[model samples]
Every structure is written in C-alpha cells, then in structure tokens.
Target: MADPALSPSPQKHLAANDVVSCNKKSIDDAENSRENVAGETALVIDSAAERALCRKFDFRLLPVLAIMVVFAPPFALLGKKIGPSRMLPILMFSFGSFTLLTATTHNFSGIFALRFFLGAAESAFFPLVIFYLTTFYRRNELARRLAIFYAASNIANAFSGLLAFGVFQIKSDLVDYPWRWLFIIEGTLTVLFAIFVFFYLPKSAAEARFLNEEEKSLAYHRIQVDSSSVVNEAFNLRESLQIFKRPSTYGFLLIEIALGVPLQSVALFLPQIVQRIVKNTIQVNLYTVAPNITGAVTLLILAFSSDLLRIRFPFICLGFALTFTGFIIYAAIDDVERQIKLAYYATFMMTWGTSAPSVLLSTWYNNNVAHEGQRLALTSVGVPLANLMGLVASNVFRDQDKPKYAPALITTASFGGFGILVSACLGLYMVFDNKRRDRRQGVKLSARDVPTSRLRDGPKVDDFRWFL
Candidate 1:
C-alpha cells in the first residue's frame, strides 16, 4: 500500500548544520517580540496593585476557565491523519508563541484570550506524545520509556523553579517586574526547542535517519509481530466508535480522573502548600525542588519495576496507595510548627505517588486497546478528560482554604483511594477474562496450544488477551 498523505518520507533528509541554522533563525526572530511583551507586562504589573491583580484576574483565571476550550480528541485524530512529527512541532511552536504573547497582556481580557489559546495548543500534546511513543516501542518497554519521558517534566519543574527563584531576583532589569521575564525567557526557549523537535524526531522508526536499513526493518518487524499489523491503521470513525463499546475504555477514563486530581493539585499548588511551613518565598521554591527530584527518582524506579515484572496494575495501585497515605497524613496534621518535618515528608509521598500513575495508566490503556484509530480516540478523550479534573482541584484549593488547606488535601486523598479501588477491579477483571479464555481453549495456563480460528486472530487482534 502507498503511504498516507501525512506519512513520513524516507528520503526527506537534512544535515545537522541545517537544523542548527534553522534553530538560530527561529531564536533570532522571536527575541525582539519577547522583549516587547516583557516590557509591556512589566509596565502593567508595576502600575497595577499587585494584590488586586492577583484577586481580580490571576485568581479567577487560574481555574476552570481555559480548560473548557480544550478539545484534544480531534487533534489526536488529526495527528492520526497528518503524522505526529509534523503535528507536534507546530503545536509546540503555537503554544510557545502564545506564551510569548502572554507576557504583553495589558489587562484581564488580553491575558484571558491568550491563555485560552495556550490551553487549546497544549491540550493535545500529552496524548499525541503517548500515541507517538507506542508506535516505536513494544507494550512491555513502553512504561519505562514513558516514565523516562515523564521524569523530564519533573526535572524541568525542578529547574524551572530554581530558574524562577534566580530570575525573580533580577528586579526589573529586562522588564519592570521579574515575573514578566519568566514568560519571555521560557517562551523563547520553548520556541527554540520546537525547532529541534521538528528536525530531530522521526515520524516512525522506519523513517529514522540514524538507523541502518536492516535496523529499521528489525524495529518495524518487531512491532508487526506483536500487534500483527503495522502502526498506521487507516483512519476510520467506525473503529473509533467501536472503542466506546469496550468496558476498559470507561474504566481507564475513571482511573485517569482519579489520578489527575492529585497530579494537578500538587503541580499547581505545591508551592502554596510548602509555603505553610516555610516563611520566605525563595525558601518555598527551593523546598519544592527536593520533593520533585524525589518524585522523579521514584517514578523511574517504579516504571523500571513495572517493565521488569511485565505487570501494570500492582505498580499503579502502589502509587495511588502512596499518594493516598501522604495526603491523609498531611491533612491529618494540624500542628504545622510542631510537625513541620513530618508534614514536609508527606509532600515527598504525594509527589512520588502522583507521578507514577499518570504514566502507567496511559500505558495500561494503550496496552489493552487493539486498533490504532480506537487507541487514538480513547486517549484523545482520556488524556484531556483527565486534565479536566484540574477544575475540581482548583475549586478545592481556594483562597478561603489556605494554610492547612484541609478541604483540598482530604479531597485529593479520597480520589487516590478511589483510584486504587478502580485499578484493582480492572486488573482482576483482566486476569479473570484471560483465565476464562485459556480454559475454553482447553489449554493450561502455561502451555502453548495449536492455532485455531480463535487463536488466528493474532496478538492484539480479535483474539487479544490482556496483559496482567
């Protein structure tokens, strides 16, 4: 069969120097605009009352607003049609441009409009990356690779906090306010990074420039054997709709919602949580680094273990267990000054548990779902639907519920507990289903059987068995 319109070309090659030159040009083009935005934000922030700005706009805009504009399933479907390598860089550049524009906002309307665009741009990214990665690696290898990929976010978070700590100290050199520099510097770097992603990332292993032809064939054939089909299935709505008929799709979505609440609450409100213990702004940012670094390490270890055991549910449940324990402990502690050290340790648990489930849950769904279009549709809805729970987190942790923030902590822990139950139920269902299929084949659990019409459906095909 001929390649699809968005399929990658094996012959489209460029030299390393060309890529470097292109990135340099992109940086140069973005610099002046970044300067202008930073200057405008600085002026507006300096003139406006800071607390009033925080209350009127930042507080109201922070939650429940932009996320409603996000509809990622279509873009996930579009990535299916157009190719992720082509699609992701464009999306990255678009969001980065919006980030740069955000620095120039003179009032609530300007910032609000730009933020909506930013969320719309970002909504498709996680699902696209998950779908893209599944095409390259086998089911067993995916969790670890995704864990490694996700750790980069934790690492970036650590660095960004440290960078903001230092950058915030600059005191109006590049802009009238240091916060304006945050957007300018980060946005410019993101644009530059998008240039590299465009040039370096291959659309598929078969199109990878660094691989020998033999290596490419081996990579492609490995997946072909596993799925009994090539990665690029024909785009079809009938197949997509068929996915909704599966019980696991709804199960995975429930698990995603359960996981997303703590993940986002911690991501957005960790500093605020830490501030309850520490007095200084610099110290609060610095304190966040240790927990994030710990989370990254825990994520990698759990992922490696998941891949090593060739299992999924145990680790996901373990992660939720940890998060639940942490949130419960942190919330239970009323005396911050007396148990500050203990409360600090609880943050480590929250970070560790929250990090693993997000990566693993996605891998779990991808492992179970058979068809390309079905996986795309499920994840497109699943990933953003998970993030949409961020609205719940935002509402739970309002200004009225500060310092202890008992309401938010308790609510997040409850979700974690719910996740644990849901994951265990799903795992049990798969195990029982697999056993029933094995028994009906007149085969013992450990034995190989003669191929029959049922068996001939192939791995991940009509006769697909779930991975425990």
Candidate 2:
C-alpha cells in the first residue's frame, strides 16, 4: 500500500504534480464533467418511441368540438347571470366526466354522444372566461391578460402533444391500447384540476381569496376609473338589441367568421395535415409540437406589443397577413412530398394568426360595448355566431382532398384576405365614427362624468371612442 501522504489524492497530487500533469488533469476533468452532463440529458433527447403514438382518429368525431355553438349562447347568458364561478365548476366537472367516459367508448355513437356533451360542457368556457376577465382588468390591461390566458391554451395544446408522446410509451398490463390511456390519464387530471379550480378561483376581484380588503377595493376602483362601468350589473333587453343594429357589430361578426374557419381547421386537422407529410404517427405529433410552440410565442409577443403600442387593428392585419401568406404557400406547393420542408414552414405561419384575432376581436367589443347589457349580448351572440364557422370547417376538407387539401387551404386563405379587408374597413369606420362624435360634442368627451356604480348606466357609444 502507498504511504498516506504520497497516495494519489488530489491534495497530495496537486503539491507534487508538474504543470503538464495538472493541465492534462484539468482537461480530463472537463471531459468527464461533459460526459456526466451528456449522460444526464440523454433521456431528454431520446423521444423516438413517444412520437410513434400520434395516429389519426376517426374524422366523424370532429363534431364533438364544433358542437359548442349549440350550447354556447344560452350558457354565456347563464354564466352572466349565475356568475362564472358557479357555472365553470359544473361545466368542468361535466366535461371532465365525459372525457373520462370517452376512453371506454367502443362504438361510434358512444363517442359522438360523449363528444357532444363535451362540447356542451365547454361551449361557454372561453367566452365566459373573457367576459369574466373584463370584470376585473382595465381596458389597457386586458389584451395582455387575455393573451396570457389564450397562450395557456396553446401551451396546453403543445404540452398535450408532448405528453401524448411520452404517455403513449407506457406499457400497460390492463389496457390493450396505449391510446385509451391518453384519455384516461388526461381526463383524470382534468377532473382533479376542476376540483382545484372550484376551491381556488374567486368569483370576482371583490371576492378574491388571495387579495386583502385594500387590494380588492383597489381592484374594483381601478376598473371604475378605467371604464366608469359597474361590474356584474344586471342585464337589459332593449339596450342589448341596440348592438345588433350597429353596422360595426356586423363587421365584427363577419371578421370572426373568416378568422374562425382556418383557426378551427388547423386546431382540428393539424395532426392529419402533418401526417400527410410524415407517414409515421409519432413523427406527425412531434412535428406539430414546434409549430404550436411557435404559435404560442408569436401570440404572446403580438399581444404585449398590441398593449404597448395601444393598437389592435394593425396587429390584426399582421396576423391575417401571416395566415394568408402561409395558406397561399401551402396551396402553391402542390408537390407536398417534394416540398415537405416548405410545407412544414407554412404550418408555422398558419398557426401565428390563430390566437391574435380571436383575442383582440372579443376585447374590441368588450371595450366599446360600455354597458353590461351590450357586453352580455356581444358575448352571447357574437361569440356563438363566430363559432358557427366551425360547421363550415368540419365539412370543408372532404375525403377526396386527402394528402393535398388544396381547396380547403385556398378557401381558408381567401377568408383570411377577406378578414383583412373587413378589418381595414372597420378601422376606417371607427376613425370616421369617432371624428363624427367629436364634431357632435364640439370637443371629445371625457370619461369623468360617467357613473361608476350603476350597471347599464355608464357612458354612451358617442361618449367613448371605439378601439380600432
């Protein structure tokens, strides 16, 4: 055995070691460190098996998501009355139960029925959440918050794909198909989360459990100062009807329809589109992950920029431009197999526009609607009407268009271009309309005199300029 002091310990070696040995040891240590780090990260880069699980489902099930229109309007109205806190929990529980039940479905009818109820349960969630958010946030604060909320959905979509990639790799003793496990695990999580939501989410800023009395009061007062509108005021019928008569409302409805077509189409059919380019199901899901993440990032960037610049329509136009150009490229590239890289790039472009218009369009009306009655009507009518484009989306990409959905891509691109035109026209109208209001008042009216406490009794349309 070596003497204790002379043994090759690092301390003893350092004292006796030559400069060349010390340098060599340092190089060895760095290489060893790199090897250890690479070993630790090997699992992260190795996802080949997980991606193999992204096979297509029967197209008939597409109606499950699209059917939300049937239940959305009435539910929006109910959520307005009963409050989203009460309604959201029940809806979450209902949909989560249905999603749980979907795993056991062996027949088409069972799947369809479950999907239908899922749609019913989720119909009002988005619009109601938007309406609920408006109660607390000021107009300037809304777009960013809404973008963040919307970004969460895109993040979920990205996460779900990544989750599916991993979850499908599990070798189950009880279940024959790993696909069934997807529904089982995700559905259970949703149910558990709904329970958490029920306990955690506050009904409104005033009722928020996390905030102190002072903070809650500040929250309430800020919204008051921002819009001079009452929070959660009772709805009115005659005044709500006035929104329907406005030309701007129709313009909004038309623009939403145009935007919704591509949005829904991509949301529902992305896996299928990617499958055409990549034969493997796992690769399809893997490929989709990048575009989705890009979309979410683009959405957040646009939203914060819109808030920073105090502009909405210019971003809306930019979103449409990206969407249209993507679709146009997709349409022009007839040889998908030969031009697969370009086709995939087009998907990134298509997804960039999906969240912007929907978020901004809703906020536009929410900001301008002024009173509770008009706000509720827009939430109830405009949102559901915009969702009606889902029906068009569900039917557009026919079986004959398999592999290359040229017609569907072109149609969606056309819609995007038309939406841009409508947006421009609406912007011009808002500018002219605001000018007319200023001339009528002989000066632009200030929001100071608007009542802060009463619902449906705040500033009139002429008193506030619309956000273009």
Candidate 3:
C-alpha cells in the first residue's frame, strides 16, 4: 500500500522498533505535559443528547431516598445470580417488562413488587460506579472525581422538585399516571445507561485506551509507592473479609451511617413535606426541587474544601455540626412557615456538609488497611450498612409529626452530635497513632503502602498521605 509514515491510519506503523521508539517519545511528552489537575473526560462524553439524558437519567432520589424505600434490592440479588456484567441486559429487559406492568398495576402488592426489583437493580449501581471510577482516575485525582460523583446528591436535591413539576404536566397525554411515568421514564434511562456502561468502561486502568506502556507503568509506580497498585490483578475473596479486623474500617462505616440516614429525610420526605404546605400533589412535588439545588451548591463547596484540607475527620465533624444546626432549626421551631423554610435550609446545610466524608473516610480506611480484601470488606459493609439505616430513617417522620417533625428532627440532630464527637475522637486518635507508629519499627505509613482502591490509582509519594 503506502509507505509507513504516509499511511492513511497513523497507527499502521506498528513495527517492533517503532513500538519502543513511540513508547519512549510518548513517555517523554507525558512528563513534559505534567499532571493535569482538571480532568475533562467527563466533558468529552457530553453532547446535547448525552447532556439531556444525563439530566433525564439524573436518578435523583435513587440513593438518598429511592433505593431503600423501593428500588434497590432485587437487582442486587440478580447481580449476585446473573453476575454484574450480565445483570444490566437482564435488568433492561426486566425493567421494561416491569415498567409496562407498573403502568397497569391495580394493587399495592404489585406496586411493592415493582419497587423491590427497582431497588435491587439500583443496588449494584452506586458501588460499581465508585469502584469503576477508581480504575479510571489516579489516586490523587480520585478526590475530585469522587466529589463530582457525590455531587449527584446535591444535583438531586437541587432539582428534584422542579423535575416533578414537569413530569406532572405529562399527566394529560403522557400515557401513564405522573407517578407511573416516573418509573417508566427513569427505568428506560437506566436500561440505556447500562448499555453504555457495558461497552465503554475499561476493565481496569491497564486496559484504558489513552495510556501507553510507559505511562501505564508510571501510573502504577506512582500509585504503588503508597497504595499497593495491583498489576494485572486477580480477585481475592479471603482478603475482602479480613478488612473487618481494622478499627478504622469500622469507624468509617459508623461515620457513613451518620451521613447517609439524614440524607433520606431530605431526599424522600421533602416532597412529602411539601405536601403538608401545598395541597396540589404535583405542585408539592415541584416544590421539593428548589431546596435540593441549594443543597447541591452547598455540597460542592464542602467537597472542594474537604479535598483542599486533605483531611477527613475535621470535615466529617464539620458536616455533623452543620447537620446539627439544621436539625436544631427544625427541632426547636413551632411556627409552620418558619419551620418549613428553616427545615429546607437546614437540609441544604446538612447535605453540603455530609457529602465530603464518605470518600475521605472510606479512602482513609482503605489506605490504612493494607489488604485488598480488607478494603473491599470495609467498603462493602460501610456503604450498605450506611444505607440499611434507611429502614429506620423511613419511619422517623411518622404520622404524628404532621407539618413539623420536631421529634424526628431532634433525634436526627442528636445523631449528628454523636457523629461530631466520634469524628473528633477519631481525629485525635489518628494523630496519636501516627506519632506512636513513627517511633516504632513496622511498615512506615506511606501513601503507596496504603491498600485503598484510591491509592492504587495515582498519588505522588510524599504529597499523598494517609491523613485520615
């Protein structure tokens, strides 16, 4: 055909000599460009259609409220049975089948069944997303990536009410009840996204398209200096179980519970709270959106701050303090107008503060606990257990609370105070332990030595510390 240099496809010149020469030049170029702090891949994926779908598929209350109340467990069980990779296509077909059923279901039990499957499918999602995100970004990069992911809550909070308003307009010719349409539209989007995930997501960093052999090696070495970066890995179930022995692992799990439960109060009940003020079901739904937008902005600020501080406990404690303040406004007030507005503001503050700690804390435990199994065990328990508290959270705003759930707000506030104390104590413990270990003869705590999923990505040796 053509001479190698003049080939139509630039990559056609893959001779053995060229491979090494290209790799070396690529490495040199990479070093010269340096680490790009601002990641723009998320932008690369965005088109008008993708942006609209991202907006439509926003999955607002799925985690904060929807999953436990209705949508998460069935697909999770299915993921166990069908395998995570296989679960999506299965879920897509199943979701479509159920959406049709949900559109016609005439009884509560049928409604409950549909909701259960929805929950199960959703269960596999959040954790997988977090784990998947790690395989793409380096360790130091994770804090920002996680911040963006966690921003979903803020986004949900910021916009849920507004979306409900628009969906309600479809009540006339939308082909289903407003509530039914909620399930149908969201479910369809889920199926579509599952398809995207299957095709595009890299199996691991080594498998990523953009990096070459040397860049991959550099990525591995930078992360491995502290995080125990695996090379062409194997799964280890035994190691996953060993994470339970670490006190820090359990501590972070407890911290997550403190963060996750209050989230539901805002995510699930806010619309219901609007019901108390506005009589129209649709309008009430619409009202729920405004506060969440405010909440999202607040969360962004907290996450950015947490990343900048490079500390977990202090931010966690601060989140608790903000949550407690909000709860106090709700708990201490009697006037309905004041209570509702303050309640919204309180939730906004709580959400902003609460979002930062999970990544920081989970990453902390993951880093401190060296074994892969332990990190997996801690994270697996930490997230679901953090969520399981929703069973209790759902009932906290009982019928007696009416427009002002003073008692529930108070209990939540008390939990917030408990979290603040726990984080403060943990912070002190971390400092003392770091000092004590410095004088001893064991594995010196370094960034690369930390076995967290985050550390296995990328972090400069000295700059990335197991600060938490």
Report the Cα lDDT for candidate 2. 0.71
Expressed as tens digits, the lDDT of each residue in 17-86 for candidate 1 is: 6778887876665554345433432332322333332233222221211111125888778888888877
Model 2 vs. true fold: TM: 0.78
For residue 402, give model 3's deviation from the true position in Å: 1.2
Ranking by lDDT: 1, 2, 3
lDDT of each: 0.75, 0.71, 0.55
TM-score for candidate 1, residues paired by index: 0.80
Q: TM-scores, in order shown? A: 0.80, 0.78, 0.72
Per residue, candidate 2 scores C-alpha lDDT tens digits across 123-153 of 7777777776677665655777677677667
Which candidate should be chosen as best, given TM-score against the real structure?
1
Please write out the lDDT profile of model 3 over residues 394-431, one tens digit for every residue. 87888887776767777777778878887788778877
Task: Report the alpha-carbon TM-score of model 3 versus the true structure.
Answer: 0.72
RMSD of 3: 15.5
Show the lowest summed lDDT stretch of 10 residues, model 2.
Answer: 53-62
**In terms of TM-score, which candidate is stronger, 1 or 3?**
1
Per-residue lDDT for 269 in model 2?
80
